[model samples]
Target: MLRARVELRELARDWRSWCKAIAEAAEKTLGSSRVYVFGSAAEGYATGGSDVDVLVVAGRLPRSFRLRGEIKARIEEEAGLPLYHPFEIHLATWKEAEANPIYREAIEKGKIINAQGLDSMKPIGESFGESRGRLPDRSLGQR
Candidate 1:
């Protein structure tokens, strides 16, 4: 979708540094090996204040670490302006990506990002399976 591309491009130009920072944290703490952008950000039609939805694939993480609040706060501080959209980072594993229908659909429709979790990304399908259509607009990561 156009919204997804525009929103992600805007983030790349503006919030990419912060996003990589978060990815570093994810890799270190969540055992993530890769990250990707999905949902509206991947669809290329996002407007102002569109939230970013990213996926992280890796081994399981410890329960103690949380990236959302801390990364968001730091990014907001560094930018000197609050992001119009919230950072929605999803944590999953390769097994989950394969086993979970929704995650699989996201991968199929998402755009891979070169970030801290991993510089290289694997290719995925383009069509969303009928049973696994687009998830909620609020947070693809959440589902």
Candidate 2:
């Protein structure tokens, strides 16, 4: 039983390291973006079968949904992780993230893995006008 526990710990460590690598790759892929780890991974309850949940909020991204996977692919490639890696990576523009319930939950409950140098950009979901990749100011009563 003790041996099993030790092995589980080692496996968890490996998963965390891999998640960190993916986060780093995402940071490089989307410059000036925020990367967060949510779900079991962020809560430190991940098991061997758990999928790493990552949320990446960027100032800009291709508007088409079809092109989103292309960006994620770049991060996977940079991380040396397979496209089928046990990761649930999400890419969101600041506006999209602000409007998305799942992204909101992740932002609220997740851990920011690439905090260094992330503060140079404006706060997430802040008013930057209706421009692409920017969140509209809800405080102004603009829908």
Candidate 3:
């Protein structure tokens, strides 16, 4: 349990650093997009071993997939944590996110580290709760 506490602290610190790093890297590489923190981290469910999840919303996908890979690899190396398994890179226009219910939900929960593409990131409508059918009720209180 003591070890778990230490790990949790480390994970929290790393999450902050990784989010900052990703925002900086995205600014340098993508130039005209927004970077957001999502998933467990955004929802305040992150634990000691949680992976840092993010969404890079852009008008267009990066021209260099290699660049994207490099950015992700560097984040992993720097954070000393494997990225959230099957890390997502949702490439879509702002309009696309506005139209998609799922994407809108993510954006609603997401915290914007950098808002370059637009002045600020806005939630389209009310954010939805995680589906009750998916997560066990007991786990919600465990954290």
Candidate 4:
């Protein structure tokens, strides 16, 4: 039983590492855009089977399934993770993130980690709005 518990803990650590790597990869793929971790991964309750939840604030991505697929492929390749890794990515313009209730709530509830330098990245979502990747000026509990 003790051995099983240890193994489980180790597996969880691996997933966290994978999540960090994937986040970095996403930043690289999106260039000046920001990649954020939320849900299980951000709160640090991730387990081996847990899905890595991510939010991407970027410029308009082509609305093509093939292009999205290629982007994911690039992330996997850059992160050195297997293609089948459990990564669930939510994409939006920074303006969309600020205006959407769901995104605002998630940002409030989830801790933002500076895996990539925020200053180094440009606000790619200016086409959507002027604000960078900042959430709307509100707390999670208010709404």
Per-candidate TM-scores read: 0.52, 0.68, 0.53, 0.61
Give the per-residue lDDT digits (tens) of candidate 2, residues 1-75.
676556555544566566667767877887767676778877778877677777888878998877898898888
Which should have the higher TM-score, number 1 or number 4? 4
Report the number of the highest-lDDT candidate.
2
- Residue pairs with colliding backbones in model 3 are none
C-alpha-based local distance difference test score of model 4: 0.60
Candidate 3 scores a C-alpha RMSD against the true structure in Å of 11.1
lDDT per model vs. reference: 0.54, 0.67, 0.54, 0.60
- Between candidates 1 and 3, which one is better according to TM-score? 3
Our model 4 lands, by Cα RMSD against the true structure, at 8.2
lDDT of 1 by residue, 38-87 (tens): 77656766555677677766554434346444643453454343454456
1-143 in candidate 3: lDDT tens per residue?
A: 77655665675655655566566666565556566677777677877666556766665554577866776565445534543332344544466666776666666667666523233333222212443222112223310
lDDT of 3: 0.54
Q: Candidate 2 — number of clashing residue pairs? A: 0
Model 3 alpha-carbon miss at residue 106, Å: 1.8
TM-score of 2: 0.68
C-alpha lDDT (0 to 100) for residue 84 of candidate 4: 49
